[model samples]
Target: MGDGLLVFDGRCGFCTRSVGWARALDRRGRVEMRPYQEPGVPESIGTDAATCSEAVQWQGRDGVRLEGAAAVNALLDTVSGTRIPSTVYRVTGGLQERVYRWVADHRSRFPGMTPYCESHPAECAS
Candidate 1:
């Protein structure tokens, strides 16, 4: 892979936390994170930053794009070569996708989420 681009909502508390976790797991910085709101991002892989704030995305080698579960899986692929236990998350499939959607949809109601969102509501995309 040229480099893994993890497009995520920079304003989301959960998203920020996850990014921190991933960064810690891959201290070499193999994955590059770009806020979906960045200007000039290509739309071919669904790069509408505002809209994509509600989803997960990962662009892999050869421009293979994965969303939701597959996106999470692709990110794991980058750390697989390291000491990270990739197999531990083998089941991030359909079920996980549904759960992800649910949490994302209702994230505003989650504890500590309101304060986080209030601090960056402009980027939260409602």
Candidate 2:
């Protein structure tokens, strides 16, 4: 019901593009974004860095937490004038998660940061 914070992978180019899209759509600036890798962020978000690394996360002013596609839906919730579409998208949990997982699985192929994962390929594989 208040400000929404989205924590995402800053190093991934794909993730960066996605954040830009969200920001562009939300003209009201209702959503704020921060990289999960930022210091003191995970603690503030009531999560750990490891979990945030795996998927996106969201925190509402009411203290509700959502992850992955659900976190995305939370961001979408503040598009200024897309309530119905957002509700519909939010309700489809299974489909959203499947799509999110698929994208995450292939993040390197998407429009994102370079060197998606150098030291550990598995880090970007999932």
Candidate 3:
């Protein structure tokens, strides 16, 4: 575990669930998950509210920063049994990013998705 950080949008249900899925695979507890909306979180991570609103952010223990699909890939790399898919994701040129953007844009339309903020306003209040 490198104490890596995964900053996501707490207001997005899809994002929260997606992070849960990732956490399930993180048997080693290599990453620390944080909601960007948390007080001082964005500034602490050298990012801004606007940037976090647009995409997920990953900060490695070594200080490397990644965003969007690349950030997802970096998170995957921390988990075992993901080498094949991670490689495919990396080799897909720009396709992975396009796919990520599409999914992000339509995330609310996904069945069973509900923003965490909506369901847990007290915990997500800014």
Candidate 4:
């Protein structure tokens, strides 16, 4: 695995949990996960913060990018315990995007997210 940056919504509990899981699985120490709220995150990737607000973004070492479900797949490819997801992504065409969108759209209702958002009311909508 090579170095890359994964920018995600730090306020969302689901996203935070997913990031932790990925980080634990990424034994190669190749991927670095950063929250959208982090200073200079968007600038470092040459994109606006609004894009990170919309979906997880993966900035490859060579400046390539993968957004939303594509970003998840790319990160999973680098993690050892995520082979099934990578395989499903490779064969499923747009399925991953649909699933990712559905989950992202309904993230507010997810367990742990509601309580986590109490500290930041604005991020609940994110």
The most accurate candidate by TM-score is: 3
Worst 10 residues of 1 by lDDT: 82-91
lDDT of each: 0.65, 0.77, 0.81, 0.77
Task: Assess the local accuracy of residue 52 in candidate 2 as a C-alpha lDDT between 0 and 100.
Answer: 91
The top-ranked prediction according to lDDT is 3
Worst 10 residues of 3 by lDDT: 111-120
Model 4 score (lDDT) = 0.77
Native-to-model Cα distance after best TM-score fit, residue 93 in candidate 2, in Å = 1.3
Q: Is 1 or 3 the stronger prediction by TM-score?
A: 3
Model 1 lDDT, full chain set: 0.65
lDDT of 2 by residue, 26-116 (tens): 8887887877766777778899989998999999878888899888877787665556645777578889899999989898887654432
| Model 3: residues with Cα > 4 Å off, grouped in runs | 81-86, 112-114, 118-123
Model 4 root-mean-square deviation: 4.3
Can you write out model 3's per-residue Cα lDDT over 3-96, one digit (the tens) per residue? 6799898888789889889899999888888888777777777889899999999887888778899889888887764566568786894999
Clashes of each: 0, 6, 1, 0
lDDT of 1 by residue, 4-91 (tens): 8877766666776676677787666778766565554436455676557768788875687777666776787785553242354455
What TM-score fits each model? Answer: 0.70, 0.81, 0.85, 0.79
The parts of candidate 1 lying over 4 Å away from their true place are 42-46, 82-92, 110-126
Residue 73 C-alpha lDDT in model 2: 78
- The TM-score measured for candidate 1 stands at 0.70
